[model samples]
Target chain A: MNLQLLAFMILSLVTLGAAFKVITARFITHAALYLALSFVGVAGLFLLLNADFLAAVQLLVYVGAITTMLIFAVMLSQVEEIRQGAAEEGFWRRILSARFGVIPLAVAAALAGVILYLYRFANWKAVPVAPDPNTTRSIGQAMFTTYLIPFEVASLVLLVAMIGAIVLTMKKEDRSR
Target chain B: MIPLFYVLVVSTLLFALGVYGALLSTNAIRILMSIEMILNAVNLNLVGFGRYITPSDPRGQIFAIFVMTVAAAEAAVGLAIILVIARRYGAAAIDRVRMLKG
Candidate 1:
């Protein structure tokens, strides 16, 4: 197997494992930590795919900013400690739900089959284009030039989100008393 | 012999798992984590296609960066909402926040 395949397989396994832990772990903090691990594995996969800029962004944005935000939210919400003996109560329901998860499995299988069929029969060729020397530069240029409108729109969306978050989190005087 | 198709297949499986987790989990934070997984799967597809098609242009990388930015923004807004919900309902489970249910 080539190095690329090896890296891809390892990262995929790590991502899947972390993702499983994220859902199954009862403690919210532990789940958030597992999510951080999954994000790191995803960053590694991005690196293997030669998306250096994206890999860095993934680590910085998702791992640094997003996960930290999640952890903060978890801490601030007063649910840091797992309730005593809560695990034993939900075991059967969890197990039963696992059986009911076959629907997504079947859908995934069908999608995979379709993707395989399309790619297998298609006569695709690599389009020759010069690789950019600096990906960050090219990305900046594209974002500021051809994709400027969308870029600005994203900024507007962020602004709206900021205002909305503040509005939602604000304490109403009537409720505070 | 593992073909590149297998890579795509595994990514799709991960995506599906993420979707199922997102839908089935009662915790709001776990749902966010599952959404991140789905985004990662899409990132894998983008980079894989870039590798198979044009290894030169880093457009895939650029797109992935955009996705990361959007994910960050999403996480921020989502966590804020969760925080407010927890304050109001005293619980963070999605099932508890059913004020919209008629």
Candidate 2:
């Protein structure tokens, strides 16, 4: 295999492996850490796609900010179950129970079936190559021009989310009293 | 050159995993993690399409960035709500939180 193909394979394998671990890990913190690793692997794939800017943002946001927030939430919540390492009956533990396991299996199977069907049928024709030097510059220009409004709106959404999160965490009785 | 088919198939599998985890996991935090996985799959698709279809322009990259931004916000709010839920109900498992089951 060429270097490009080899890199893609390695990055993708890393990404998928970490994602798989995220779901199956025994501890929530383990899952969160794996999530960070998964994000970094995806960033590497983005680098392969010549999306250097997107890769940077993925590292800064997904791998850094969100993973830290997840760890903090896991810490702050301090759930009794996870604190003592979940004695038993966690998600993986309960998978042996047919009643609980069947639904998720069915949901996943159905989704996979649909996606595979679409992939086989879709007449996708394009193949990507290495990006030219001006790709990022053009993107920046468009963001400030045609997409300026959407850019502003995205910032607004972030602001709303910030306020909403604060309100959601406030004491219920604080305003009621 | 890597076939786009490989990328699409991998993304589809990731999406399937996300859906499975979201539906099956009893832990609210795990569900959120799965949701993040789903979003990442979407980002991969967008980036692939952008790279192949419009190498000269990065409209697809911009869209992926937007998705990431939204994802960050969603994680912030979702975790805060989960924190509050765990605090109030003393239950990290979604199946036990019955305050809004109606």
Candidate 3:
């Protein structure tokens, strides 16, 4: 009823709608755009949770970096052939294709039902309290001091991923002959 | 006070959508995108728990950051591999990607 609740409702709706579109959109580019929109909503949710740092990272990394990369990858992959292949998959390629969607719908429904049931019944550990206001400072302090090893490992993972990507894509054309 | 269960509901819904998308998707890139959705769902839960359970410590937020880093790395590698596969095969369907399959 209040602004916070209203914001949460709207943001959650936007995020869920965008996520649905990301699955159902006809064009890959459109799907990617929807994914970015969903990421923005998630960032808003992060802010709602008082994780300002995480919100910024979500915006920068998920919306800015990942979505752009997804678009580029979609563009570079040349989706014309994909359309043809998809067409061959059948006539049921609408927003909700029965051939591809029925099971997933059932699965999502069952999952939601089970989770809500457990969540309602379980003896919860989280106690409601006013959110700690100084989240960014505390997160930064802990990242460097307490979780330094995991932070360093994350950077290492990124480095290895970079090298792996280069190796995967580095196919030299035989035109050198 | 904003109830924690609502946030949990939202995140769990997101996670379910992600699972469905990842399972039903045929496109390699879309599958990867779905995986990102799944990661975001987990991150949301982490932040929610962090806010409600241990407001004094920022461990949950830091863990979420680490998750983001790994997601970036995963996206880079996944797309690179997908690009190579698409180049060689001229299609992006994972069903057709059987080069390494025995």
| Candidate that scores best on lDDT | 3
Error of 1 at A128 (Å): 6.9
| TM-scores, all models, native as reference | 0.82, 0.92, 0.91
Candidate 3 clash pair list:
none
Chain A only: TM-score per candidate: 0.77, 0.86, 0.86
| Whole-model lDDT per candidate | 0.71, 0.84, 0.84
Model 1 residue B29 CA deviation (Å) reads 1.6
Tell me the tens digit of each residue's lDDT in model 2 across B1-102: 667777887788888888888887778888899999999999998888787777777888999989998998999899888888788787777777788732
The residue-by-residue lDDT of candidate 3 on A1-177, one tens digit each, is: 389999999999999999988877767788889999999999999988888888999999999999998887777666465533344343245326765678887888899899889988877676656645688788778888989899899999999999998888876764345
Please give the distance, in angstroms, between residue B96's alpha carbon in candidate 2 and its true position after superposition.
0.8
Model 3 Cα lDDT, one tens digit per residue, B5-99: 99989999999989888878788887898999999999999999888888877888888999999999999999998887777787788887777
Stretches of model 3 off by over 4 angstroms after superposition: A82-99, A126-128, A174-177
Q: CAPRI band of model 1?
A: acceptable
Per-residue alpha-carbon lDDT of model 1 for A43-161, expressed as tens digits?
88767655677788888888898888777777666643222112323523664654545554566557656766776787767455444356667668877887788778777777887
How would you encode candidate 2's per-residue C-alpha lDDT over A18-97 as one tens digit per residue? Answer: 99888888888899999999999989988877788889889999988999988887876667754322443665657777
Question: Candidate 2 has what TM-score?
Answer: 0.92
DockQ of each: 0.47, 0.69, 0.68
